[model samples]
Target: MSLSTVQQVLARIYTDSKLRDDFLTNPDVVGISFGLNCQEIQQLSKLSRQQVDLFARSLKRKRLGEIRKLLPLTNQALGKEFNPLFFQYSETYLPTGNKKHLLDAIAFTKFLLQQLTTDNTQPVSVLDVLRYEAVRLKMFEGKRLLFCNRFYYHLETLINSLHSDSPLIPYPQPNIGIWFRLPNSQWRSLFIPFSVKRKKIFSFHRLVQKYLAIQ
Candidate 1:
């Protein structure tokens, strides 16, 4: 019932394999409560109207049964007061390879969660994830490569230069991969694994606060 509990529930849902699978496989799960209009959802999903219709058709009664099983595990902390508009915004800005779209998706998800939870203390929202993703994708040349051990020393300097007031957080600058622009004008980078435990969220939040302080 509390905000922390709600976040935990959502986190569990995020990590739930069965829920993720069901979400992707079920057409019914796609349309309901998306907070977006049909046209908007179509545009965001990059699917034509016919494709959306076909996808919607796949949501049979049998699949709903599967989602029902998981529904009771959480106390519907999502609340019963569902707004079609929220889903419209959420569904209309679906994640895509497009940088603009992805950034919008992350920001909108954060906003929706903020609205639902009404808690400001643990401000780890989709925006944090987006920031992490952006930092993960950022490319630096020469001695600034800090994503890996080969240049760990350089990473410390780059981070120190952040001055606890810089807009950028201190992420390891070294990565194993190169960056390139995709056909869609979105930037892509294939890098070695960058692990983020729960603690990093707090660290990033602090970084955000520190950045905001000087501004």
Candidate 2:
């Protein structure tokens, strides 16, 4: 995906006021960069090569939400500004990176599953469960890196739609659906050289560059 394409897709996504607002309020939908190899991407996302192949083959003809299980995820962290624009860019530009796409789909599916299976539903608060799970999963260790308020809101909308009078499909949950990256010593050690705030900023851009480079 070219820089222009990334910019265009992001522009298209954020051009809608609702999506933009949703993006700002939700963090789990946030996209982060990953430089993982093919095997690693597959393993992290818990998808077989053939499944990814099938997903890629169907992407062109299927609705974006339909291919929900094939988005890739970043085990790394992202800054305050990052959100669904990462997804918008991937879907628009790197649609063939089925592993990355699967990660997003899995995260989304997990969220939907949580909504349907949570202990409480009177108020229909999937966001609460999502926040708790995200914390339990250590999506953000010291502070939030990805996973934002906008991500939760949009996810709530998706789950509600799936459970509406005219349903889309039954909820799904895979115990190993969530994706995470193994840390590299070189990358980890590099952070020690920077001040706290600088390290956070550095980590954000370096990760974003990984995705941008592929584009």
The number of the candidate with the highest TM-score is: 2
Scored against the true structure, residue 149 in model 1 reaches a CA lDDT of 19
lDDT of each: 0.35, 0.35
| Per-residue lDDT of model 2, residues 111-155, tens digit only | 444543463532223333344344333442323334322122223
lDDT of 2 at 139: 46
- Once fitted onto the true fold, the runs of candidate 2 whose alpha carbons sit more than 4 angstroms away are 5-65, 68-98, 119-215
10 residues in a row with least lDDT, candidate 1: 70-79
Q: Candidate 1 residues 1-215, lDDT tens each?
A: 34454333333223343443443454245433433345533433443445534444343222233322322211122223223323444433323233533344335445544554464432232223223333443322122332221221123333344334333333544323223442446444333323333112223334345535655
Q: TM-score of predicted model 2?
A: 0.22
Q: Provide the TM-score for each candidate, comma-separated.
A: 0.20, 0.22
